[model samples]
Target: MFLKGKTALVTGSTSGIGLAYAKALAAEGANIVINGFGDADDIEAERKALETLNGAKAIYSDADLTKPEKIEEMMKQAADEFGGVDILINNAGTQHVDPVEEFPVEKWDLIIALNLSAAFHTTRLAVPYMKEKGWGRIIATASAHSKAASPFKTAYVTAKHGIAGFTKTIALELAQHGITANAISPGYVWTPLVENQIPDTMKARNMSREDVIEKVLLEGQPTKEFVTPEQVAAIALFLCRDEAAQVTGANWSVDGGWTAE
Candidate 1:
């Protein structure tokens, strides 16, 4: 219960990697504030589950990440309820994959707003409170694309690369305040969303299931295995510990050697 009195706000936590982060922090006895869009019943279930797991308060916000006003309202709610955030995980993101020439301008705007600008807004709001307390953790979910480029994902790659830079800048600014800021870069994370895409990819490519998994899905990942959300969550939790006080300003890659190459 090292984090018994801490409060963690995880964006896009209704499912996938974000949900995994909420659960991992909740297991360590941190109060949870989760946000994202999903079924009402499902969201409540996750909120209740987190509360039950650690006997800590858990709340959900349906804040639209693309809008700063909604993000402000969400942060205000967290402050009113929990006295302010102690750990902030900016993980809400959306992707639109198309060739640069055919990319939709609206999609580019949306992706930048959610994946990059939202983190900036949340960090600015969270930092004042963290500085007042002299301790905090700020973690952003970047991607292998942050370090390496791939075709047809111009917006995603740009936003992730921006996140890496944002993390480093803030880490240096808050270095002596007992706060640490870092980005976790995962490659080809295996989620239900990713799973659902495989069949369509196989059909489009006319490849066998194994070929799709290896040649298409896990091609850039040297391990030939997709990174798990739980694994990323574990690393995030580790960054919250006293042992990780000096681990700021780093983009920790959990990308199965994708970025290593």
Candidate 2:
């Protein structure tokens, strides 16, 4: 058990990649703190599901990442339950797609708040505890868009790029304290947030779903497949292990060769 006796706080983990990460960590013997912004029913359901996995003590903290106060509160709750966070996965993010000329300011602001600024708030709160313990892992869920630009996603790209930069800088600053920060840049993972956009793109381009996947989404990928959430979670689980202690300030890509070209 690589993470035995450790505690991990994974944000936006009620479903999709975040949920997968929480489960992976728990399976490694880490007590899990799952955070999500959703109704009580759905949150509780995820909480129960995680608890049943290998006797892991899974708890839910419903915090709106857009709010700094709420982020602090969530950190406090996790610390109270698990003594301190050994791992912090900044995985909560929202996306918006629109042409630059017509993009809504509100949407841009919201994406930046949740994707980029929220990490800042959460990391700030988590670091002191980590420094005191002299050991921690901070993983930010960046995207391939962080390194490469795409059409109609200015705010999303900007936030992801900011995450990469933020993680790198913090990794340097926190190295002496036995804390490491890294970013995972995934290509295309089929999550509800992404699946919802498929129809919108199809309508806008007047193409079938197959056409969208073949000609637009997976067109540049050498593997011609969407990266799975479980695959990404596996990499995340590895990074949280003690053997990966020397690996910091890195932006790892699990993009199915999407960015290799």
Candidate 3:
């Protein structure tokens, strides 16, 4: 496998898109560090599964991404175990829906922390190791919201937009170092993150669950299909390949034409 012998660290990987990322990397034989919160037994099962997939090691880190100290500890653990993160996927995120003025102050802070700031913290800690090795891949899971706006998702949109910008800036800074940085902007992935947001959106827009899925969620995309986590993870794997070496600073849209409108 092209990624054999490399090490990858995927954040928010206990389930959903994050888990998909870890699995894709493991299939290519990359030692993996999966981070997030979930049931203890289920997580251990996935960790063991990853090792089986790669015939390499896989670790789980329950680092609270919002806390800088915990992030540092997680990075340290990766360094100690696998030298450092050769590929870093900052895919952890949360969402809340409400009018801008009526949005919860704490929710806004939490969304920003988990979605945007955590990526920043992880990138900073991982970059030095990448630079020293003269090779690295940094991919962030931005959203179609990063390019377009939807009602009642101010904080999520803002954080994703910030991720887009962050990817561009880092790409330039690391361009000469054989390290590529990019953002994968998917339209509406049918994950827990998106599924859980429907209720808040239903409440915000006074719509039923069916209406939220049909009119509110799928209305923007011509395809009218939810993007799969595997699809998004596939793009991330492509970014780690040598063929994608010149593909830095770009935001790839896997949104089924959601942004085409």
- Writing each residue's lDDT as its tens digit, candidate 1 over 1-261 gives 889999999999999999999999999999999999989999999999999887989999999989999999999999999999999999998876666787899989999999999999999999999999999999999988889887667898999999999999999999999999999999988776567656655655678888978887789988988899999999999999999999999999998898777
Off by over 4 Å in 1: 192-212
lDDT of 3 by residue, 172-231 (tens): 999999999999999888989989999998899999999999998899989999999899
Total clashing pairs in model 3: 0
lDDT tens string, model 2, 1-261? 677788899998988899999989988888999988667898888788877777768888888888888888999999899898989999999887777888899999999999999999989888998999899999999999889998878999999999999999999999899999999999889898778777766865788998988887888778989999999999898898778999999999999898889
What's the number of clashes in each of the models? Answer: 0, 0, 0
Q: Lowest summed-lDDT stretch of 10 residues in model 2?
A: 196-205
* Order of models, best lDDT first: 3, 1, 2
Q: Give the distance in Å from residue 173's predicted Cα in candidate 2 to where it truly belongs.
A: 0.4
The Cα error of candidate 1 at residue 22, in Å, is 0.5
Instruction: Kindly report the root-mean-square deviation of model 1 from the true structure over all alpha carbons.
Output: 1.9
Task: Between candidates 1 and 2, name the one with more favorable TM-score.
Answer: 2
True-vs-predicted CA distance for residue 207, candidate 2, Å: 3.5
- Model 2 whole-model lDDT (C-alpha atoms): 0.89
Regions of candidate 2 where Cα sits further than 4 Å from its true position: 203-206
